[model samples]
Target: MSRNQQIWLGELIRCWKALAPADDNTRKTLAGLVGFAWQPPVDQREPEATPAPEPELPPPVAPSAAPPQPMTQKPKEPPPNPQASELPRVAIEEEAQLQAAEWDSVEVLNPPQPHNRQYNNLLPPLFRPLWSRTIVTTLASRRLPIGFVDAERLVSTMAAARPVERIPRQPRWTTMKGVQLLLDKTPGMAPFLSDQAALAALFDDCVGGEALERLHFFDSPLRGVVIGGKKAAYRPPQPGVPVVAVTDLGLGAPESHFNRAAPGEWLSLVQLLAARDSTLTILLPWPAAAADPGLQRCTAIVEWDRSTSATLVRRLLERICG
Candidate 1:
């Protein structure tokens, strides 16, 4: 073949080797395309056959007459450091001794006396009784305004009002005489009657003039005054009313003495009273406009601001000189 033809054939063989499928039929087709006879390369000569050697057998020995003896046990080795073994024991003993010494050195202290008798004896004879009475009175009068002497009378009025009982609804507006008649029927309304003008002013300041105009008076079964709409209606008690203080508003904190979670109990009894009595008046510290939406349902809300020093002095003088 010419050099150019040889180069062409070389390129063709390489392309066939790269692109063709590697198989016997593919090799035959490649040979036919190249115009060469197809045949597998012949083996030069048969390799000499060699047989594998058999595995060597181990030698057999005769059995011994007696069983083999157990190996002698090795002696237990001692700890690497002898002192380390005793360290823990020594430390424990020292700690115990130190604790014993400390206990022994500690001086016995006498219990303190509950009260110093010498100091107590120095006080005046009337001091103990007066102090005890003051403490008890202060503790017992939770939520009650200080210097309010008419609380009991007010409570009585609330009790006589029978606020929980249903009454005939009246017109929104009524005269002072109508109020007086209602108060007269309820035994404990003397406090409200003491200062009608002041009461009216108080109502005017609390609810707007519209509420004051529509006001109807009712006697509270607990000796207090209940002020609500003339047409307000109360539901009847389930069977009876539980004993409770009329001043209870049922808004006390859970931890307060006035909390009403428990019925017929200290503060809880007040909650029962509020639930059973619809005529109870709640004293709100803020103006009606500032009250929360939940509190808007209240029939009346009274706002009381602290009196100034001048006002207090003037009132006191008027009372004293009068």
Candidate 2:
């Protein structure tokens, strides 16, 4: 049958299985009518036991002359066809090339070694706590260039490495809270919270009268109430007055959340936020695993594993020392 016909027939069988009753006679009759047989499943039956074969007796030993001379290395055998050496050097080279190509095509099951320093150094120490060693090593092997390009590659590699697992919600929340606490502690900084009402009040307090008219909020798929209008037009935050934008793309549940927004939409959202020149603090549940393209646009890509107080303290120490 044609491929399409086969597919249709398979689908029909699946539909039948779903709709049909659990009567064995009905199933057997229907299966026979469809040119198929309903045999009892092999797994349901106990396998037959087989008798073990008897061990074979060793061959009878033959008598040897001179009480068996001391063993010596076997003489090297001559090539089967000495004339084969007369073949063209080009032919020999071609054979060697084919062998090398076969080896190259073989997949290496072992994990790759961590070698690329450029990729490793691209990530900041503060953010290193978020990624596992395996993830880092995988990214480094790709030798991705610095900047958003590396982010794209990292996301793709992460997705390929762990295709089924979704980014956990708790880590994203924890990282968001940690980053917020860190920024809040910093003097003279006004953070843009996810709470729209609170953010509106904060904007009024910070930007005030005339600036507030230029500033407006727009709802975002991944982020809520993105500060747009004239405020978004600014390239960089003014000194001593930093606008911190906080967004948490919480655990992408119900596949539709991501499906509704094309990967490009997420990328554009990130780019737009990045262009605003605000201190953009994004909390995303495992973007790499999701292969979310927006991940590549961010300045920092930190893994938010379940971090302990000791780990946090160690990171802080490293940050201070550096």
Candidate 3:
């Protein structure tokens, strides 16, 4: 213990002894604690037996008129048993403190240890349950279907000689390509660990584990990273695949946190995806406007927070379909 702590303890033992206050539970507890620790009058252990008395030589007797009084001897007392005990006392033994306490002593207490803690979820649910397919459609690739006929085109294919063996449906946009999930794994995204897990489970249900591919990147996707113990140069999935990235775009970082993604870093990513004819959906904790306006124009940005709704995801699909 430090000198200051020992000094305070000495003062506490002294003042508490004088007060002998026990009006409340706090005071009573402190008294008990101090008594238990200092224990000025702790019980002393008792020995099993006293050593045997040595043999005494006969004493020289003086001749007297009356017969010498028979030698008188005192009886020996047995040693006290160690098993006999006394309960520890918190009250000071001084008569003055006892009299003062009877007149009513005041109580005091040090702060007790915290018994409870404030709890909070770093990430709340964004998408409602059973709406997995909605997210799938929002983040999946759409392509014009072949082997199907437009109603207008079929009406124009006039020879009338074509057998109606196969009824051709109208050509339309179909959500066909698998999804690529790029989740940020930097220290800044630590709070969203649970959020990532929920998102992963939802995507797994939509495309199944085999169809969904999840890649973890430290700060930016345009940098080299390791996956499954193999280091690889960063690359996006095949062309026409949708990439849904859950990132903060370094907007959530403090000024001192330099190891974060910048607008340029993400813009380079946007250019790469554009070249591949793939859409990019950024699930950010903040709004799309927080990022550079130019970057927002190229990437479909959706806030990855509780405020996100089914309508918002539909809008994302509309943006991608365009």
Q: In lDDT terms, which candidate is top?
A: 3
Of 2 and 3, the candidate ahead on lDDT is: 3
Candidate 3 lDDT tens digits, 160-247: 7665555556545445577788888776677887777777766776566677888888788888556786756788888878888888
What's the candidate order when arranged by decreasing TM-score? 3, 2, 1
Q: Could you estimate the TM-score for every candidate?
A: 0.17, 0.22, 0.53
Candidate 1 Cα outliers beyond 4 Å, as residue runs: 1-185, 211-232, 235-322
lDDT of 2: 0.34
Candidate 2 residue runs with Cα over 4 Å from true position: 1-251, 256-260, 285-294, 303-305, 308-322
Clashing pairs in 3: none
Q: Give the Å shift of residue 41 in candidate 3.
A: 66
What are the per-residue Cα lDDT tens digits for candidate 2 across 1-322?
4464454446436745465634557655554554444432212222334664565876767675334532332345455586765876776644433332222122222222232122223323322433433322221111112223344545766878856344322111011111111111111111222232333333343334333322222223332222432324323333212223322332333434442334564456445544543223332324434445445334233333334233443332223222
* Backbone N/Cα/C clashes per model: 20, 1, 0
> In model 2, which range of ten residues has the least summed lDDT?
172-181
Best by TM-score: 3
